[model samples]
Target chain A: MSISEAVVMNGGNGPYSYEQNSSYQKGVAAAAMDMIKEALPTTLDLYHLPLSSPNPIIRIADFGCSTGLTPIQAIETIVQCLLDLIKPIKEPRFRTLEFQAIFSDLPTNDFNTLFTNHLPVRRCYYAMAAPGSFHGRLLPTASLHFAYSSCALHWLSRVPQEILDKSSRAWNGERIYYVNSPAGVVGAYSAQFGRDMEMFLSARAEEMVSEGLIFMVVPGEPDLVHDSQTTLGSELELLGSCLVDMANEGIISKAKVESFNLPIYFPSEKELKQVISRNEFFHIERIQTLSHLKMHVAFPTPESRSLCLRVALEGLLCHHFGNELIIDDLFHRYSLKVAKSLFFLKPESHESISFSV
Target chain B: MSISEAVVMNGGNGPYSYEQNSSYQKGVAAAAMDMIKEALPTTLDLYHLPLSSPNPIIRIADFGCSTGLTPIQAIETIVQCLLDLIKPIKEPRFRTLEFQAIFSDLPTNDFNTLFTNHLPVRRCYYAMAAPGSFHGRLLPTASLHFAYSSCALHWLSRVPQEILDKSSRAWNGERIYYVNSPAGVVGAYSAQFGRDMEMFLSARAEEMVSEGLIFMVVPGEPDLVHDSQTTLGSELELLGSCLVDMANEGIISKAKVESFNLPIYFPSEKELKQVISRNEFFHIERIQTLSHLKMHVAFPTPESRSLCLRVALEGLLCHHFGNELIIDDLFHRYSLKVAKSLFFLKPESHESISFSV
Candidate 1:
């Protein structure tokens, strides 16, 4: 399947929906709000927005916004901050200026929930939903004033071709990720991330106005930490091991495990910085590393952790494996394993890297 | 129920969805396309649209667009006409202008089906979905350049209150619409349509630029035609009789039928002209009456007509009567009645009224 058709979070507000399981992303937005407020006046130059025009309309967009609850809080903060900043100005047109919030995601996104169920009752912006992939262009050229995204960029446009090819050295046999796989597998994932980032940055450059500001929160690994030492890496490895355990008993096939790799990569700050700097279209204002350990408070039990992971990955896993019973059995085994792996990885693996451009 | 929540059609591509049952609306749109193409150049002043601005973007909106199949065709024709008109002009900036299409409907609309399945594989405009009541402000002030709607304006914001008041002379105790009702009931329906159109026109005026163009295709009655002589009026009356038939047999209560009324009104050309003239924000360029009889080709059999009507009104009926079995039984009875109503209405009942402002 193409990347756009997959990679969708479970939709609607049911027990396993992305909406019900997205509290960690909400915490990520809350932690990043202070940086968003502090950086806007310096890097964004909010005072000179298009308040002088006759329409005086400002556009702010959130890309890869799944069902829009996470982006709603962040966008509300940005709009409220802008309104408060311009309150002291005597320009009547500044007071008349309005904001248009664009909530964008893949076309398969559940926009009915986004617009009807998640939008605030007393918000101060006109809401619109744009449905398309974010890896390429979605908006009009040079029409965006502010662009924001969170917990979305780690998803590669597609999994690496080399990891799926049996003849390649990067063939990830019996593994679903590059946790302790060969270096060639890691290199292939890193290369795919680089290419996707180039496309993402250039597309944003074309969509944003010359003086626009962008804020993003991405899953990332620290430069000195190994992949298997992070929380995300350890969890993925635990789940892959459980899949192999099932395959051994004929519950699933080994070839299925070898062929299905997660289309995700945790880039280091150094790697992300190098890509942004090479593009020459945007200057990285700051990269803040945040350990999102507080989010674990919402999922204290192993069952809760397993449920969150299931809600996030159940859609993709079902698409690959085509059996819900096997998935249920694997997650049950995986959660028990997660309960005992205290020495394998550090809690600092919950790091989220945020930046302004 | 609130107008924003209750005006929705049946969602998704199920057997009862509005998407599959709305071919008559498509025919209404196609019938209006010729007049749309002929009226644009002289009335709209399309050549001078923000072509020289740094970020040249033109926005077009469709209010009351259910799942956007009807507007997709109309919007494509409009964009192609604009592109062809600008091709002969020797200005480079005119070629740089882009179009943005906004599809507006009630909050409960099925936007997932709209943006995912109905959008063209290749189209010129960037598509966006706006969810809210069109009777109030939705877009930013003066942000719209063109506005369009077809077969949608006849829907009132809500059912008229006088029709539900027990003591009022206009109370429609046994009927669901003003067909063959008393003069007081007809007057009450007309007054409600006038008020709803006032709110609709003023909201568009605030959202549209001074030079923007507005086009609408509304279900309408000729001045000489009686309420019992039109297809829509006769069909609605037939359904109401079906409800009364069930109520007499104790299948449902009389109070439930007494309190229920369809939230719709079809105005005469004289009434529409008077309302538009009183708004003062827009000038009516022309009003052309069209008989959309070709839509019958798609619904030749009584069963086909029954299914189409069921898909269009099942949600509203189920909400009022609160039983799916009753709705199915009502439609079953009404379809047989429609097949026998040979002397009640003429084939000319299939009329649509279009106007440009």
Candidate 2:
């Protein structure tokens, strides 16, 4: 979708409604726990901070923290794990060090819901909100101890310029996403993710203390014969077909479908390594792709699994076509398309990566 | 002055023009350096924070940081003194620890001037702004390391309700301040200060770690024979007479002058000690009164000295009268009155006090 019209998870009720359909985020948050634990020991060992230092307060920032209790829930897991790791240490001074947990997101995020109604009364850390974009500097230099973001890195800062220009070679015609699109369209999305990632890393390098750990859960192409050969690719292809079919049926205009493109990309392992190695600020610790079918094993039906994708994409669809677009009809048809694709296509994959700087 | 109508020094120019007439605040900031140093040794000793601790960043908060470069200047001094104190400890881990300087004031305070256009780069510590009032909780509980406030504690969160009530015995009639007012009116202001101090100490107790050093510079009565015997008291008395004479001349309504009272108080030495001792959270560290004339050696001219008072009080007067009131006329009359009083009146005493909790 256009930058100004970029729909974020349905601000109102819909399948893509973050409030009603965030089980996917909850699952992603659960999977991120192990990665956080693996990164903590090295973070604690390498950070040469003293207990009696001027600001003996630990700062943990959760960027792209969406509305709901999940953000706090995720922080509690990290804080509790760190506490356990520190409890065994014999330093009495460490007990007095305070934790300042800063939860940040876009200015439009529901901070009132996050801080006023949902924040727990007896949190181990001091809770505060820094409302801003993560693509730029949010805190002061060398301020953060640990940074964590879940299911958020895939979204680009904005629609790539080449894709939006009608005369540009990268114009994404007849498709709403990069996956399964032409090479030119795919290259444009990849380029935007690379630029956004560079900005993100630079801002983070200035903010993090030496050897601070960063954990990000990203949707990526699984290791296979071809990078785009995955079930998620088929799912997006079917969803695109549904939109085109709607346009043909005169339910929506063809130009409307062409104007809308999801500001997201699923980077392959090679692409991720190229960007990470290019920026010497961070040393890659680990990169692993988790299977979508295995991750969604708790859901016994295809519709349940498809709900996760629909909840996230509905906002962009509704914003571009019209807010009056029937969300239930859209998702119901989309779910059937996904179920049909699954009959012949394989399950897709999502990846998680860690860094230390 | 009504809260909404308070025309704080011409934000662009005039006495309260923090940009032009902050010599008085600068003097107070300089005088505060010694107290901060004294409190630092104890604060560093009792805090028990380790340099290599999890969150080794020291947090120093400057409450009531009005618009100007003085706040930065004052914080640089504190951060430098602190760095010097910590340098001799010989802990390698201390090298990585950073300081976070938080500048806080009322929401309307010129934070834009303090942060965006004025903040210095390549400093020793991280800088940020916390926009809120200090009377209630501002920072997270147990989050602060060292707290300092100068020439600001005199402002009460709200004017005393008793003085505002026309039918109450404590109603301050024909007076714009408590200095030399009727005993009941003076007692109302005193009572308000006591209550506010209690709330202030309690909130700080919850927000500060055990044994955090809090340095406060309060303007109060010296060890004199009479309450109004101080120079500051006489200055206020002279300013009050100017307003009364103006009301008599129909320059301003008599009722207008009677309805306005500054939400400020210069407590006596006895009153200062009583409040600290009453609250168990803090121990009185030091209390001393310095002569305003001696403090303002840089300001040799009577008008220069009067400008300090006029800059701070003009907003209140404009809020009480109309914003359209001629500031030059008001301050000219007030300056002449101050010059006349200085001919015979002893220089006023302004006290400074520090606390450790």
Global lDDT of model 2: 0.67
lDDT of 1 by residue, B189-217 (tens): 88888899899999999998878888988
Superposed by TM-score, candidate 1 places the C-alpha of residue B149 at a distance from the truth, in angstroms, of 0.2
Which lDDT tens digits does candidate 2 get at residues A76-187? 8888877877777676557566777777765445443454345665567766555456888777667687888877777888777787667888777887776665677777
Pick the lDDT winner.
Answer: 1
Per residue, candidate 1 scores C-alpha lDDT tens digits across A1-357 of 455557888889998788888777777777777778887777766656543276677789998888847778878988987777778888777767889899988888888887788787567899998888888888888778889888888888989999899899998999888888888898899899888888888998998877887788887877776744554576788888988888888888878887788998888878888877888788888777754545356566677677777877786787888862377788899779867765223433354344333
* lDDT for each candidate structure: 0.78, 0.67
Candidate 1 clashes: the total is 0
TM-score of chain B of each: 0.92, 0.87
List candidate 1 stretches off by more than 4 Å. A50-52, A227-229, A291-295, A323-326, A343-357, B1-3, B50-52, B227-230, B323-325, B343-357
**How accurate locally is residue B253 in candidate 1, as Cα lDDT from 0 to 100?**
91
Model 2 ranges with Cα > 4 A deviation: A1-196, A202-357, B1-16, B50-52, B91-95, B228-230, B290-298, B322-324, B343-357
- For all candidates, the clash counts are 0, 24
Candidate 2, residue B112: the lDDT equals 40
Docking quality category of candidate 1 according to DockQ thresholds: medium
